[model samples]
Target: MKPQHPSVRRISECFLKPDIECLPQESKQPYYLSHWDLNLLPIQYIQKGLLFRKPSEAFEDGHPFMATLLHRLKRSLSSALFHFYPLSGRLASIINEHQASILVYVDCVNTPGAKFTHAALDLTISHLLSPVDVPLVVHSLFDPDLHTAVNYDGHTLPLLSIQVTELLDGIFIGSSFNHSIGDGTSHWNFFKTWSEIFQSLPPDGDDIVSISRPPIRKRWFPDGHGPIINLPFTHSDQFKIRFKAPELRERIFHFTKESIAALKAKANAECGSEEISSFQAMSALVWRSITRARRQPQNQITICRMVANNRAKLEVPTSEDYFGNVITTLKVSAKAGEVVEGGLGWAAWKLHEAVVDNTKEKFREAVEQWFECPCTFRLDQIFVTNSLSMTSSPKFNIYGNEFGMGKAVAVRSGCANKFDGKVSSYPGYEGGGSVDLEIALFPHNMANLEADSEFMSAVSSPPHLFHQ
Candidate 1:
């Protein structure tokens, strides 16, 4: 093993006295939980990989690397909050009440001699799951004891008792995290930071740069807010739904930067309007896809809600990298049939109008007003569009999320079980040339969606998009 870097040592020491003040405070209202407080639970799941013969041989000296990794983990674990530590009885209680709290275990099988590589892990996980629960933690309340872990089967290093099956030899690091901590980006940032520290590398200097503070105690509802309606849980009755499917429930698609530019030009030409954004273009594609899947009439007023982070727009500087939710939702409604009939360019223009047209202040005001009342509002679907630049090695290093093994293949937001649909976008594979989209819809809806030719063609076409 290599010596721990000076900076890495400093980071390990810092966790020993983690600044609680750095974490956001929970509001007093019954349901007004801070993103930090809600996502504090840590659920553990495992990621497995294979080790090469040479690397295995190099570790012939009795499990020394395992000991060192454990030592560092113990030190770091001691520094952070112990709230996520599962109480034997409490864990059972949660399992009984919210059966959905069951953790998801993902296995990444690699060929032997396959050293653990960051890019491979990213691709594997990206192809497997979206960061579903990570994003939900921003808005939902969570108990502690949420985490994921990985278990290794074969190895030359005796980290743990290596139990081999007929197939592969590799490492499994259990990933445990509280959903309420932060968005997928924030969680990935933490994992990347941990990995860098483990590898004895300097943490990215700009990674921890400060952003605006979030408004802590604003009244969400000043005047009397009224008639909050809770939508029925369409698929809640079927709790046995599998996490991944032979065919995905929702398809993820992307458009290249150039493609988006071309779409905008086409939209302008057709609608006699100004240029639109990539987000709008993508949204238009999805809206059309959904309508085609549902075969709904043109007059149906379908709604598309876009999720926007309000950290920068707030009066105070929000903790940009803070672990909890700091987002507000905005809705755009159009006749479903009209959108599909009007063509992708028209729908894209509508989406653009809904997004860029809104003032920053309007978003702030909407957030303030939401908290003014105690109403629990729900929506049909949400779309999260962000730059993939976030996951780049220099910008954010998820590969460094070392729990003993190496980094994760994919880190995604929680599945959208609460609503009719959920969608998220990450940076495209190569640079910022394109984007990767993940969509989650009700299972039945997903089945209907997969059979649609138009939707399938769009997904399989030039840019390429599909459900994970």
Candidate 2:
């Protein structure tokens, strides 16, 4: 049945630049894109949002309330940008004099500012949480126009666009960032900082407190890798088709501390090793269930690609505040029959080994190998066949983001960069080893996977209904 919810309608739009102009002496040249950033050039923008119950102090949702919100948000965001100034800039590129290389950079000098939008939705928190699957309307909470736009689109569009939506009894802060500018670490860092600043404001005064983690503008490069890596294409027209993402049904599976602990224990017992982490056990269960759901041929190969962070493994230690992508993908494969019949523990042990092999030396080698040909990730790798990939980390403090409102009621993602077999995991609101796995799969596979008894046994849902 069609979701019984109101459509979102845009009300206002504006740019929020740095509150204080940066000094030219302090100003600098264009910030070059790292090879890690370039590898995601074909990917779509990262559009995600944090939902909150309506603020405790009640006021009419008329122009006065929204107008005040727009004013305060713009101010707080502008202040936040002073530290994360690159987000306010536009994407700029220049072809070398020899015309052999195309260099992409962020024009920090211009400081184009992040986009802030105000929209209205006559929907309630209940409308979102009651659904078995995420309501389709939830996707539109972020701007609809940029839903499928790739990362390179940052050249013409605002590098960062945030939509502050007013719901019937809640608010949704939807953010869309240029994927090349940052990964989930950089993304949430900005949000967490903004929240801190927003909460510190005194409604009328702008005494923004210092943020916990400031942006670290240093982009990482492996030794011998070019500080000035060039794109093969001279013109933007040639940088196309990173890969097409498939539209799939998405469902959020909640694994409480108890459920995850049990899954981990079982996995360790089966492998005769107590080292299987909760994440690996959960991944194994999901992978095995998904393979069963697809009903692939017995001998068909299936792969699980997990994104690993390189902040600690960088040739040099990278602060978590570094404002760019610093991660790589790790893959584990087995035939469909082997994965399905191996039992959760056996499959999890395989995953544990993959994680252990991702050492600092191994990461440096991968970076060097990339410079050899220099290519971005493609869909055929993990999405086109009996394969799946995981991104985002449960360790991220997404639930802690509070912009004067209470802690986030839930975490959600937009439609961009999503495809069949893509999974995003978050630390469950209840915390303490709990996890929320947002899995995307072919519509048929989703239905079948949900029916798998072994999978459903550890799953919990219907996110606790919100109260303002």
Point to the candidate with the largest TM-score: 2
Question: lDDT: which candidate is best?
Answer: 2
Q: What is the C-alpha lDDT profile of model 2 across 153-233, one tens digit per residue?
A: 778788899998899878999999888999999999998888878777666654445787878876777777656888777
TM-score for all models, in order of appearance? 0.53, 0.94
For model 1, give the RMSD to the true fold: 13.7
**lDDT computed for candidate 2:** 0.82
Residues 162-209, model 1: lDDT tens digits = 111110122323332323223444445444444444454223331222
